[model samples]
Target: MNLTERLAAQPMSNPRADRVKDVAGLAGRSARSKRGLFLAEGPQNAREALARHLESPCVDAVYVTEDALGRHPDIAALLERVAGDRSVFVRLVTREVLAAMSDAVTPQGVVVVCPSLDVAAEEVLAAGPRLVAVLARVQDPGNAGTVLRAADAAGADAVVLTAGSVDVYNPKTVRSTAGSLFHLPVVVGADLPELLRAAREAGCGVLAADGHGDVDLDRLQDASAARAAGAEGVDAVYDLARPTVWLFGNEAQGLSAQEKALADHRVAVPVHGRAESLNVGTAATVCLYASARAQRRGADRP
Candidate 1:
């Protein structure tokens, strides 16, 4: 007699259910922004979100077809309860229409509209000793998404994209996050100087990556080692677990001289390959993982 039982027992007729086919045609970011809503698609992620947050009634609207109901039995009940409201609809979309509506190439035949979490920079930093990846002017959506995934995997406190970075909500970028977008705090429209000042005030050290730097990032094992080196103007060098910010710059030009000057220290990943430099995203993942390694070492030390 529940929603899933109802879905399983009921008869189906409507092929093109009452749902928005072209989500892009529905509204702009301002509308989604003002209403605190964003699109969620695919069966696996949809079911996960429903299982985790929908039971609390946080889910606003859900669009599912009869086929999706049969395929995703786990979420059928949850979807039915949420979809009962007029605001929610179980729409039947043609595979072609769903494909167009979906950001992913292979439409999962299910999608939902839900609330977005507004994550603040200070709140994220306050969570603990921060590991923040500050991405400056990174235009490539894939690169941006890869950096976000890396930040999530590296257990970063937050990821901040300064002005000029690709849109975080762009379907391509969002699709590339692979569900990490939901797990971490992402702050866009960052003010570099303000962030730097705040990190410094919070006792966090800032390290800017440059192909040309005073020291290789692989060298600094811990805060004590960095401090002992006593490199002039290098501040406390870098302790990745000590509320640190890692600055990655544009893909083509790398870090600008002005941006480079803002860091307390410049560090570079040592290269042994034939290539002169790592791709922006590859370099970022390596840098973030290095921080993770250093932090693990710090934690293990008695």
Candidate 2:
């Protein structure tokens, strides 16, 4: 039977059903880890999850309220397409059921149960990625997610969270990623030293973003621009146009001395304003885009 037909035939109305509780349990790290699954809440997340499912079949099931289906026909259509040949189950649920399965204050009427999407650190490095973001002991799920989203926006190849970092599958982190979680590879529980060594072996320079860094980000950008323009005698500190791995740290403590030392260079974002410091997310965004712009400009150069 078609997904729409099946959904109509079995409308799930119980908010406290065992099945609903099982899906809702994914909000907890233990449940997500034990089950090897996580929840993708809201229309955007659902859409991205389903899109990924089409390529990889990671999604297990989809639950949506009729109101949400009506409001977001694109999601409904994608669900139907994903369920056509796969075991991806689609269920129509009441608003209460969706709310019960969600961790949001106001549920967005749809949730997708998907397997953990993290890949191995070695695999990411093996791919010879041009840009990567490594989070070392970042405790806040929101900040981690925001950095992941920013990295995706900056066209980064992957994001790696170190061993002491917050759970990337945390509900708040998932929400903060919006749909970017599905856009690039994310590696969780990575050994920072090992990953940095692997990155260097793969010919990628590692840079730590620090408030008191020795290298100024603006100067690197200017130097990169000069080289791109074929200017004579450009004294570049570090080549921003080359493959790079960015190390970001905790939102509160920033990077530890040891963590900063692991990187080949420490890059600081210039602060012209009166603000004390830039947040981790903002700093990561600026740093990543700088590398992206330099790399792109170099790639486009004759």
Candidate 3:
């Protein structure tokens, strides 16, 4: 039977059900680790997860309120498409049940339980990616998710969160991704030094985003632009068009000396407005887009 038929047959009304508690337990790291499952709360996240389910069947089940289904026709349509698939379950729940299953303050009426999506660092490096973002010791869940979203927007091949970083599956981080979590490959619990070594071996130049660094981002872009335009006698410091891995450090302390040492060069994003500094997410977006522009421009060159 399809989702609509199943919903009419038996709606989930109890907030205190064992099944509801099992889904809610995913908010805790220990429970998520044990079950290898995570919650994708809200319509935005649920839509993305459902779309991915159509592609690869990563979603385990979907729980939603009738009001939410009416409001988001796209989500409802996607759920109908996957309704017949035995691997994915769809259930209609009360608002109270959805709230009990969500970690958000104001739960958005839809939630999906999905398996962990992180890939191994080796697998990503083996793909010969041209652009990568590495989060080293980034502790804030919001910062981590924002950087991942930025990387996805910048068309990065993958994002790696090192061992000391926040859990990629943290509900705040997952929500912060705003559906970008399912858009790209992410590596979690990676060793910083080892991943750097692998990236270097894969022919990627490692650059660290440092606020106090000597290598200026503006100069690199200018050099890249000059080279792309076939300017003569333009000696570039480091080619932004080359395959690169950008290391973004912690929100509070930035990259430690040891982490900085692992990169080919430390690049500073110029600040002309006299603001203290760019947050990690903003800095990562600027740096990733810089490389993306340079790379695309280079690809267009004769």
Candidate 4:
């Protein structure tokens, strides 16, 4: 029988229980880093965390209020699916206890204690990623998380958060990802230049998304067509279909001259509207999808 079919061996009813305090403390970075465990709250986050449990086996424990199992059949089904796993313990938690363990204003009655999702920059690069997103000193959790989701939607191989960037494990950041955090390998706290070096060594053309760039994104999109047309001098530009790593800078400051220059091309998202400019999140979506589309079209180019 699956875990859903069976009741948890123990029931945790105290909101001020010692275990509740310990789990709630995971909101802090030091606690998470030292303990090598983090909290995943809500039905969505817990479900995704459960999905990747086998690969990393990060799910240490799961707590669900009775209401949760009844309200969210999907979550109940997921618990049943992984019931045989000895590493993760599924238990019945009081609604108050679930609220105490979560940072959300309205707790979803489902929470998971998981390990930090950190991977070595070298490990992901070893796979020869076709697409990567490098977040350099991105302080805003929303922007950072949105970029990750966009990267995943664009089929990026992995995401690297530079040393000065916001914590990928921050509760707001984790929630902002909408569960995409579990969908791909995310490398955090790495030296930006070294990560760039690894991507370049893997034969990826690193493009920095700078609004004031000399080359527009539309031009880069035309490179594949130019290559097929036997056009003159157009081959000098980047081929988006080839392996690529996109470097996006901080929300307010954007990239410095040196950082922009490091990339094979400094790219700008074309703005036809009267609006001033696109934020980092919108810009990344535009750039990444542009690459995805270019690579898709390049495959069919005669």
Which is better, 1 or 4, measured by lDDT?
4
Which residue pairs of candidate 2 clash?
none
Q: Could you give candidate 3's per-residue lDDT for residues 147-233 as a string of tens digits?
A: 999999999999999997999999999999999999989999999998989998999999999999889999999999999999988
Listed in order, each prediction's TM-score against the native is 0.78, 0.98, 0.98, 0.93
C-alpha lDDT of all candidate models, in order? 0.70, 0.92, 0.93, 0.85
RMSD of 4: 2.1
RMSD of 2: 0.9
What local lDDT does model 3 show for residue 214?
86
Candidate 1 or 2, higher lDDT? Answer: 2
* Candidate 2, poorest ten consecutive residues by summed lDDT: 80-89
Model 3 misses residue 281 by how many Å?
0.8
Cα distance off (Å), candidate 2, residue 245? 0.3
Q: What is the TM-score (0 to 1) of candidate 3?
A: 0.98
User: Which digits, one per residue and each the tens of the lDDT, describe model 2 over residues 120-160?
Assistant: 98888888999999999999989998999999999999999
> Which lDDT value does model 2 have at 157?
98
Better of 3 and 4 by lDDT: 3
Off by over 4 Å in 3: none
Clashes of each: 1, 0, 0, 0
As for TM-score, the candidate ahead, 1 or 2, is 2
Q: What is the C-alpha RMSD of each candidate to the true structure, in Å?
A: 4.7, 0.9, 0.9, 2.1
